[model samples]
Target: MTHYRIDALRQTLVLAAPSDGLPHCTFWGARLPDGADLAQVAASAALDLTGGMLDANPELTLCPQTAAAFPGQPGLVVRSPDGTPLRPVFTKAGTKRTDTLSLAYTDEDLGLTLTFRFAADAATGIITASTTLDSDTPVLCDWLAAPVLPGPQLADQMIDFAGRWCDEFQPVTTPWATGIRARDNRTGRTGHEHFPAIILPARGCTNTGGEAHALHYGWSGGHRMLAEELPDGRRQIQFGHATASDPLPGTRFETAPLYAAFSDTGLNGCAVSFQRHLRDRIVTWPQPDTPRPVHYNCWEAIYFDHSLAALTAIADRAAALGAERFVLDDGWFKGRNDDTTSLGDWTIDATKWPDGLTPLIDHIHGLGMTFGLWFEPEMVNADSDLARAHPDWILGPTTQPLGRGQYVLDMANADLRDHLFTQITTTLSTHDIEYIKWDHNRVLPYNDAAQTRGTYDLLKRLRDAHPEVEIESCSSGGGRIDFGIMAHTQRVWLSDSNDALSRLRIQHDAALFLPSCVTGSHVGPRTCHTTGRIHSISFRAWVAAQRHMGFEMDPRELTDAEAATLTKVTAWYKANRDWLRTADILRLDAADPAIIAEQQQAADGTRFVVFAGHAGTSTQIAPRPLRLTGLDPAASYTIDLANREDISSLSRGTPALKSGPLTLTGQSLMSQGIALPYDLPDSMWIIEGHRA
Candidate 1:
């Protein structure tokens, strides 16, 4: 028997290989003592024999094999070229260890080799694992999971996400069951309906306390997740590409990296791990030193109706309101007056701007705001010039039904990618554009792993050519938001629904895997375009301020008072954005269920800001005290209600915080919590704190 251990600051994973078979994780949890005995630990984890069971239980290896008689779902499923199911029993062949670990296993008779790789980052407390399969001859890969890991036995329920167009990042919790709980996303995109992540919280776990484990499958195309508890009571988690995503026979197949984390400090620990890893490690910023700019998008403002005069005036107003970037949304391309036409035609619309986009770009630059343009390069309208000219470039059958009046382009085709690269580069070279809002308004008719790889290739090529330009991944809202796509883009449009009430919940839940810097939340019109619900400017502004601040509403529609409120919040965001950009967003546990709140703490723990949104009316009279987390308990701090003036008239008695700032020890503040000023539904209270 051989034992190996990988350690992060907060957790450790120990793998054991017995009888020269593929290694299986024997222990995964809090870090063990440096002098601990690995061999004894592996022996301690063994299950005793029972009646009706095999004399010796088969090891649940990294890639559990059918030939090994493992009871749970096999991690790798493949077949020969003629469709004969192949069961390859992998045996230890080689091992490599450094900062990262790699183990190789071979099945000589099957002419196949399997390898598992793991890299543990102590700073981020995340362990990234992946699996690869190599065959001497071509084989069809039905499913290939990343390195399988043991699920936490103490966890009673697991949380996954399910959402739709205007609503994203909604958590769905399920109790642990005897059989498998599987989630498969076959939409060809990292869909809003199926976010590729799972969280296992122990029985008493909360947002800020107790043990938890999480795994995010960092693949944007599509994925399958399985959390299975065998009859023998052992649990295993498996994540991989959507079953049969690779339809063609190939000699090599690999699964995308699966980011796994263990948190003894609760769900927030896992959240912070993913957040920091994505922002600090995975995403490559174009301008690393620059502060995130306040964005103003003109999709809900002007839609497809483009006029130079209207847009220029809007740009002037946006600049006045403190917008540092102006993004001209859809309808900019040739003959594109609506979503029904002109997709895939990247040329500027001569009729919409006879002078081209130069005038708008120049005017925006003149106002001290950078310019960004929108593009849907992956989709084509049937009436588009590209589609009409090269019908073969369409991905699916000609008779396939259209989605949102557009069809997916064959991204797997090098020629199509080359054409798109040239078209996009021509525009980038023609203008002084600094950003691109890359939008995918529709899903592909079928799933194809090659399509995602091809898109990544094109994005990489573009980034290499125009390294200074930044990109945002926007797929009709939150469709393609995963670590995979984020590798090539800087920001993500959290959702299309700009309703402040909805945004409060969405942003809070999304913080599990996304940090504030890369999450783009925008203020919309008084009446939301998607939900048709009206919200006050203060509520909208504060909610948007929770992440990468932006505005998506028309400035012309704002009343003077509304505009004043927006400008004030914009200024506040700008003033604190330097620290806010890198802050760890800690979700507060509000005693009142109606309140959705979060605390953004500075890296040094010297300053913090809390945004408490009154999502709805409280069940009982008066507001309940909300407790904050991730604080220095022994330090003294001063807390002030930044928006005390927004308090409603119904609050007759003066709350201590409503009247003036209070100084207290962090322990007292966290233990007893703070009483916030009374506010109505759809309103938000801003509280600022500083160490005294």
Candidate 2:
């Protein structure tokens, strides 16, 4: 038997290969001491023989094989060109170790080779693993999972995500069962309904305490996830591209990287790992030294009605309200009076602006703000010039049903990608545009891995040409958000619903995997256009301030008092954004279920800010204590209610926090907690903390 182990600062993964077969993970948890024996650890994980079992239990290798008699779903499903299922039994071929571990196994008779790669990052505490298959001849791959890992035995329930448009990041918890729990997203995009992530919390786990494990499949295209409990009681997790997403037979197939993490410090540990890895590692920023600008998008403000006078006036008001960037949303392109037409036409509308976008761009720059434009480069209206000229460039059948009056551009076609690249770059080169709001308003007709890869290629080519421009991935809001797409983009529109009440919960849950810097949360109109519910400017502003702050509402509609409140919140966000951008967002455990709260602690642990949002009325009469986490227990700190003036008149009794700042040890604040000022539903209280 041979033993191998990979260690990060907080966790360790040990694998064992017995009798020269593919290695299987034997131990994965908290870091073992440097002097610990890996061989003994592998031996300790061995199970005893039982009746009704095979003469010998087959090892659950990284890629469990059907030929090996593994009693579970095989990790790799493939067939010969003639459609004959191939069961390739592999043996150890080679190994390489450095910062990352690579192991190769070969099935000589089948002329196939399988390789597993693992990398442990000390800084982010994330373990990224992937699997690749190479064959001498072409083969049809139905499914190919990233390196499979053992599920923790101590976990009683698993947490995944399910959401929809306007409502994203809804956590769904399920108890461990005897059979498989599978989720497959065939939408051809990183679907809002099926986020590619899973969390396994132990029997007794919370946000700030106990053991937990998490895995994020970093693929923007559709994916499949399986958490299976075998008849023998062992569990395995497999994540891969959606089954048969690759239509054509090929000699080489590979799975996207699967990011795995172990956290002894509870769910927050896993959250922090994913957050840090995505922000610091996966995403590549154009201007790393510049602070994130306050964005003002003119979508809900002026949907398809484009007038130079109205937009210029709106830019002035947005600049006055502290917006540092102005994004001119849809309807800029020629003949695009509505979503039904002119999607693929990248030229500026001569009727709306006979002088072209230069006037608007110049006016925005004059107001001391940068300019951004919106584009749906992957979709084309059937009535569009590009589509009518090259019908073959459109993906799927001509009789296929249209989505949102548009057909998906054949991204897999190099000619189509080249055309888009030239058209988009022409505008970027001709103007002072610094950002692109790349929107995909509709899903593809079918799942195609090549389509996603082709999109990535185009994005890379664009980025290489225009290194100064930033991109935001917006798919009708939250549909195309994952580490895979994030690799090419800098920001994500969290959701389309700008309702503050809904945003509080969505942002709270999304922070489990996304950091504050890349999540774009915007303040909408007094009456939300999507939900038709009205909210006070104060509630809306604070919720937007929780992430990459922006405004999506029309400035012309704001009353003087409402504008004042927005300006004040915008100033606050700007003042503290430097630290908040890099802060670790810790979700507070509010004793009151009605309150959705989070603490943004500075990297140095010297200062922190807590946003306690009153989502609804409490079951009891008074507010309960909200406990904070991720603090040095022995340190002394001063806490002040930044928004004490927002307290409601409904509560007659005064809470200590409503009066003045209180000095206490971190332990006291974490254990006993702080009493917040009484506030009504849809209101939020801002509390600032500093080490004393």
Highest-scoring model, lDDT: 2
Q: Against the hidden reference, what TM-scores do the models get?
A: 0.99, 0.99
What are the per-residue Cα lDDT tens digits for candidate 1 across 1-692? 88999887788999997656789999998889999999989999899989999988888778888998998899999999999999997888999999889999999998999999999999999999999999999999999999999998998999999999999999999999999999888899999999999999988988888999899999999899999999899999999999999999999999999998888877889988899999999999999999999999999998999999999999999999999999999998899988888788899899999999999999999999999999888999998998899999999998999998999998999999999999999999989999999999888898899989999999999999999999999999999999999999999999999999999999999999999999999999999988889998999999999999999989989989999999999999999999998888888878999999899999899999999999997898889998888888999999999877688898888889978999989998888999877789999999999998
Task: Give candidate 2 misplaced runs (Cα > 4 Å).
Answer: none
| Residue pairs with backbone atoms closer than 3 Å in model 1 (clashes) | none
Off by over 4 Å in 1: none
For each candidate, the alpha-carbon lDDT, in order, equals 0.92, 0.93
Tens-digit lDDT track of model 2 for 435-459: 9999998888999999899999999
